[model samples]
Target: MMTTTSEIDSIKKYKTNELIDLLRKEDLELYTEDLEIIRKQKINGRDFLNKNKEEFRNIGFKLGPALRLKEFAEECKKRKKRFSSYKTKKEVVLTKFGIDNSIKNIPKFVPQTINISDDDDEFQYCIREIKRKMEIIGPARSSNEAVRCLYIETILVSAILIVKRIVREKIFLEPQREIVDEEATG
Candidate 1:
């Protein structure tokens, strides 16, 4: 069965003794006997998050699933750290303003979509800029100009994806649409 977005979200919010269920959701080839072993172990979310591949293998998971589980654990840990840091920064800002306790209805952070022009000019410009900087710093691994350009473009695109994902996670605050509209009109 295909997992819906809500189902995926619920999966991300894993609870104690739900590691096996998570494995199942990932569509890993797990045996019924493996499920029974995992249930008996009763691993909690925190413990699961802390486990490495070797540790997971020791806990009745096969090598491939163990590796995938370790990756999932790392991703989960990274998300928790990012969220915790965001909360800490928000609290610090609120405390600094002396309105931490007084404010009960703080607005949620919303991500805004930025419209890039439907042309390669901007992307090519970034690639050229990065290539220029790379030349100044040191020679690229490949002496072939085309190869270097391709490498630089790949890095630039990957960086954009990383930033977009971070923003999508609501790690940074943006003005609400209504507030932005009001400011533009006023």
Candidate 2:
């Protein structure tokens, strides 16, 4: 959303240092005032609301990267497998059997294993590994177990939505650049 002159002026009423400090502290009072300033400035209602919505969404967005872990854990639970230790090379191979069995029982549980992996790569690699394993196991039953699985899936989906919203806002709401006549002799 575009920041209007009046909004800018209102924001200016607070000392720059104070504003910076408040932002750092995540002071809700200052946030409320900022919202009021934006409202008074007659900024586009839709854009303002969208921006505010995304601002709220940002809180949940950070959790997105972590959802893969949760989903993997849930999938393991659904297949009656424990998501335990894998610190050593031997542990990985031994644990693979239980994971494979779980996958065999619940195919959907197979893909979920794709989410797991070594620490060297992005943490998401572990999540991807879990997911891959889940796919191999096949689809899960649509009973009580399914209900619990759905609940976990919902949380993961929410996380993904939060991340998407944050990315969209960052890409679209960033300030535009002004053209400079550098080529012309000053």
Candidate 3:
């Protein structure tokens, strides 16, 4: 689901237009800066992939697929699919930028094979692991510009979805429509 009111059944009472309006007003510059910082700090997509492409290959996602990630997220919600993968993707974004998204006890459950300790910040752990793999590259390899562009775009779009959710949750401070209407007439 979009996590906004229009799509999710639980919050169906909320008007979609209102939520979208509030979202449009949020400080998106913070998110944009965070993404830019990630871009500056990281090895570019080509280098990262050249080193650890196998780590991502088994993810089984078809690059350059016609459907958007939001559509895929909606389908997952509809089917009640385990969000382990979604959460993993989110964690990677958070780690890459060292953001602390402290949401816990997410409603859905998925069986995870890896043992994780309560003290471990999974986000930072993932960041370090990927960095290590990149640092250990055997030889420099040629880059495919088209695939790299697609990879970067996909990850950035995914991060945008996560940022949108955060903004929506925090946007409740906005005045209600009735309040706005009253102020306008006054």
The candidate maximizing lDDT is 1
Candidate 3 residues 1-186, lDDT tens each? Answer: 233323333322334343333223432222433333324544232232122223323333232221222243245354433432355677776666666565553435685454334454443444454455446632124284434443444445444444455456533223233423443531
For every model shown, the clashing-pair count is 0, 34, 0
lDDT of 2 by residue, 1-186 (tens): 223444334443554444434333532233444444434444332232223344433434234322432343233333332213224565465466655434444335443222323453334544564466467644445464544454455446544544555456533223224434665422
lDDT (C-alpha, whole model) for all candidates: 0.64, 0.41, 0.38
Model 1 agreement with the true structure over 1-186: per-residue lDDT tens digits = 444444445555666457677777766576777667657787765666678999989978788777877887677666655554555666788888776855675666697666654454555666676777677755667676655755666566645655666477534334334423443531
Q: What's the TM-score of every candidate structure?
A: 0.37, 0.15, 0.16
Error of 1 at 17 (Å): 4.5
Residue 5 in model 1: lDDT: 40
Top-TM-score candidate index: 1
Ranking by TM-score: 1, 3, 2
TM-score preference between candidates 1 and 2, better one: 1
lDDT, residue 12, candidate 1:
53
29 Cα displacement, candidate 1 (Å)? 5.6
lDDT-wise, the better of 1 and 3 is 1
Worst 10 residues of 2 by lDDT: 77-86
